[model samples]
Target chain A: MANDHILKRFDEELERLNATINEMGGLTEAQFAKALQAVRDRDTAIAEEVIADDARVDALDVVVQEQTVKMLALRQPMAVDLRVVLSSIKIAAALERIADYAKNTAKRSIVLAQGSAPPSAVAGIDRLGRLVRAALKDVLDAFADDDVAKARDVWDRDEEIDQVYTGLFRELLTYMMEDPRTITACTHLLFMAKNIERAGDHVTNIAELVSFRNTGQNFAEARRKGSGALYTTDTAP
Target chain B: MANDHILKRFDEELERLNATINEMGGLTEAQFAKALQAVRDRDTAIAEEVIADDARVDALDVVVQEQTVKMLALRQPMAVDLRVVLSSIKIAAALERIADYAKNTAKRSIVLAQGSAPPSAVAGIDRLGRLVRAALKDVLDAFADDDVAKARDVWDRDEEIDQVYTGLFRELLTYMMEDPRTITACTHLLFMAKNIERAGDHVTNIAELVSFRNTGQNFAEARRKGSGALYTTDTAP
Candidate 1:
């Protein structure tokens, strides 16, 4: 009976941890969308909101990490439970960084809004943001369902985000070269694009972690260059 | 007698971990210096070496992390020893990232070397790299000597890095606006500078961890914006 009670408490804590992570992901996704909108619409209010709200995300990150540490110290869970706790800690940090990046993008948007006309070159930025958000969503879903196939799909999407970033880079460069006045805003957009690119990388990290949790096998092949095909490997098999 | 033997083994393992970290820091410092020279002097060979040698740094990071984990699992260290093991893991990851940034800067040097005039605007980048490298060295020194004051000094130096990054942003913007032909290389340089700036931030993270390990206090003041003061007040004092 005592063993059963302990197991029940462990399960409850795990559930609570997952709930917090998902809530944090939702907040991050909302901020990412607002950041893009702020850039496109030149909405300084929204940009400032994103920046101010970053503290909340930072606080949540600290809370989640503390909880994970406590669980490690108290429970000393092994295998799957241990991996989940470890992954939660890292993924929480990654999400907080993503929020920071979004806030940075919003800050740039404010500067760009105060300056010259919005450059048409930012179309790629919007697309990249959507791609990364979708990737994050997919990774979260995979985590909830333990669907390794879905995680693999998220990993595959990173290449697309990278391509969009490359195209955006070229377009932004052309804009900056054409007019010196556009330099400040265009450079800000460049950072925003890089942030989105990094968010996609984080999503990939989450997906890899999900796969590891479902399977004991290490995904060493996916860590290398030109490893795009490795992302297609179905962890279900 | 068994407890005494375990304590001795734990101390020896801790000493080994510290030595490895110090060695890793030295290698990273050397790499950063060589990367800066490669950019300034257009030394392709040195740049290539930095790129090729990144694997060693990554491997060292893995080894350090594994050792720390083993200690935690086997020895079950408490209080200060536990903090030391945990902080070592985080510090190893940060150092690996800083090394990665150095490799990134070196890679950009190759592209910059291909330019017609060596991108006259790279002076800001040079300054930023120097600042970041110095900050990293301070943080590592603090870790080695457990000097909380030196760690606080590292935190203060982050602002100088941020200032240099801001200046570099404007200069790179001008380079991109000046000519479309310079776009590809200038964009690369921008990413490199951002990487270095991020490396500095990671050093700050290490500094905070050092403080946390020494004192049970979290030092929440470090998270405040524009708190560029070189000294931290001990709450107990």
Candidate 2:
């Protein structure tokens, strides 16, 4: 009877970890959304809110860490349980970083609001943000459902985000080259785009973690990098 | 007698892990240096070499992971051993990312070679890369010696890298504003500068990991973000 009670408690603790991860994942999704809205609408108030909410995400991350270490030391999970625990630890870290990136994008939004931001560039960011937000949601769903197939699908979609980002990067460079007046605003937009694209990468990482949790396989080689190399070409005189 | 033999074998395994981590660290430092020299000298050959060498770094990262998982499963380390193992996992991951950023910079260097890169901007990147490479070495030394003090000192030095990066960012903006022809070159330099700055952050993380291994503390709240916000101001008309 005592052994049964201990095993049940371990299950409960594992469930609790999952619940916390889901909670943190939801908040990062919200953070990314607000940050995107802040940039698209030039809403500094919303941007500040995204920045302010980062502390909460960080706190949850600490909870995840404490729980991970506690479980590892006390429960000493093995095999599948161990993999789940390890992957959750990584997923929590990725969520914290995603929140950080959201905060960075919000900061850029505030700065862009302070000046003249080009509508076209902001629109491009909006498109990229939409794609990333969707991917984040998908990855989170995969995590919650323990659905590796969905995670694989999310992983493949990262190439789409890369394509969009590369396209937007080229557009911004052309905007600067064609009209130097837009150079300053375009530069800020450039950073903002990079921030959003990087956020997409974190989301992709979460997807990979979800898959690793299930399969115990390393998917690093399968990733297709975005065309970031294309823009580095010598368009200079 | 049997326990003694098992314990000694565990020690040997731990030592091997440390040896591999140091090897990876040395490679990342060399990769960053070569990428820097490639950018500074506009040498495509050196850049190609950096790009080619990245696969070796990635393979080392895989080895680290395999060892980490094997140790956790077979040895089931505890207390100080657990902390050391966890810190090494993070440190190894950070080194891999630093190598990746170096590879990105090398790719940019190749592109910059095709165009007219501004000498001033290349000089700025060189300065930032030198600072980052030195810090990387110090963190590795601290790791090898298990010296928390040197690790903490390295953590404090990251602020200087931020300052250099922010100053370079502003200078690039001003150059782009004054001379339209240099905008393309300066833009690439800006990305390269960000890459170097990011590598510095990874180094700082390694420093913090070293301290964590010894003290069991998370020093994240103590970080001072550089003046990235300084350049994102209302400099636009």
Candidate 3:
């Protein structure tokens, strides 16, 4: 009976952790959506809202970490439970980082909003932002459903994000080269686009964690690198 | 006697974990140094070396994580010991990220070498890169000695890096506006400087982890923000 009670409490805590992870993901999704809209529409109001909401995501990460440490100390769970518990910390950290990147874009968006930006550059960044947000949504679902296939799919699709970013990179350079007057706003747009691509990379990281949690296998050997990925990431083979 | 023996093994494991972390840090330090030199000298060979050496840091991170999980499962340490074990993971992750940023700089350095970059922009990034490396060294020492003061110092000094970065950001823009031909190289330099700033932020993160590990007190409340940090980070209190 004591063992049963302990197991019940463990399950409850696990459920709570899962729920919190979802909340963080959901908040980041909303934040990124607002951030993207702010960038697309040049809406500082939405950008400010996105900026303020980042703290909540950070707070959620703290919540997740505290719970993870408590569970590790108390439960000392082994095998799959252990992987899930540890992965929660990694996933939450990754999500917080993803949110951080979104916040960065929002900050730049405010600056971009204040000035006139090159249309092609703005449109290019919007495409990148939407793609990044879509990847975030897909990876979170992969995490929730324990769908390794979906996680792998998300991992594989990050190349598309990089391809778009590289193309946009060239376009931004061309814009600055063609018109020196637009240099300031174009510079801000450049960082904003890079931040979104970095966000997409974080999504791939979450997908990797999800795959690790489900299969208990290391994906390092099987990791695939898109050629365009090196242009931005340069973090892997 | 059996308990004493088990305790001895735990101590040995922790010592090994610490060694692995130091090894990782040393490798990242060396890698960043090479990356900086590569950028300063525009030496593709050194840049290539820095890029190739990143895998060692990644592998060391794997070692730290695996050791951390095993220690947590077996030792089930509480209080300070647990914090040390946990901080090892965070520290390794941060160091790996710092190295990743350095690798990025190296990749850009290769492209910059093939072209004629503006002298002022190149000099500006060198200064930023040096400051970032110095912070990394200080934070690592703080972690090793459990020097809370040094850790706090590193945390507080990041603003200087941000200020430098912000100044460089403007200088790059001015160069791009003045000479459109320099746009490609200056843009690469711009991202390299930002990556260096981000690396400085990771040093602050390691400093925060050190403070947490030593004081067992959360310093999130004591966090400081620099005005220039907003131009770059914008992720703060």
What global local distance difference test value does model 2 have? 0.84
Q: RMSD, each candidate, Å? A: 5.9, 3.6, 2.9
Two-way DockQ contest, 1 vs 2, winner? 2
lDDT (C-alpha, whole model) for all candidates: 0.76, 0.84, 0.85
For A34-107, candidate 1 gives per-residue lDDT tens digits of 99899878898898788778888888887896677667666667888888787888778788878888877877
Model 1: how large is the Cα RMSD against the reference?
5.9
Q: Is the docking of candidate 2 incorrect, acceptable, medium or high quality?
A: acceptable
Among all windows of 10 consecutive residues in model 3 chain B, the one with the lowest summed lDDT is B228-237
Which stretches of candidate 1 lie above 4 Å from their native place? A1-6, A218-220, A224-237, B1-6, B117-119, B175-181, B217-220, B224-237
| lDDT tens readout by residue for model 3, B110-151 | 878888998778889899989999999988888778899998
Poorest 10 consecutive residues of model 2 chain B by lDDT? Answer: B228-237
Clashing pairs in 3: none
In the range B27-127, model 2's lDDT, one tens digit per residue, is 99999999999998888889889988998998998888778766776676878888888788889989999998998898888878877877878888999
Point to the candidate with the largest lDDT.
Answer: 3
Q: For residues A56-150, could you state the per-residue lDDT of candidate 3 as single tens digits?
A: 99999999988987887788888899989989998999899889888888888888877889877898998998898889999999888989999
**Best candidate per DockQ, number?**
3
lDDT of 1 by residue, B142-225 (tens): 988999989888887776777777677667766666665666667677777777778888888888988878885555764754
C-alpha RMSD over true interface residues, each candidate: 11.0, 5.0, 4.7
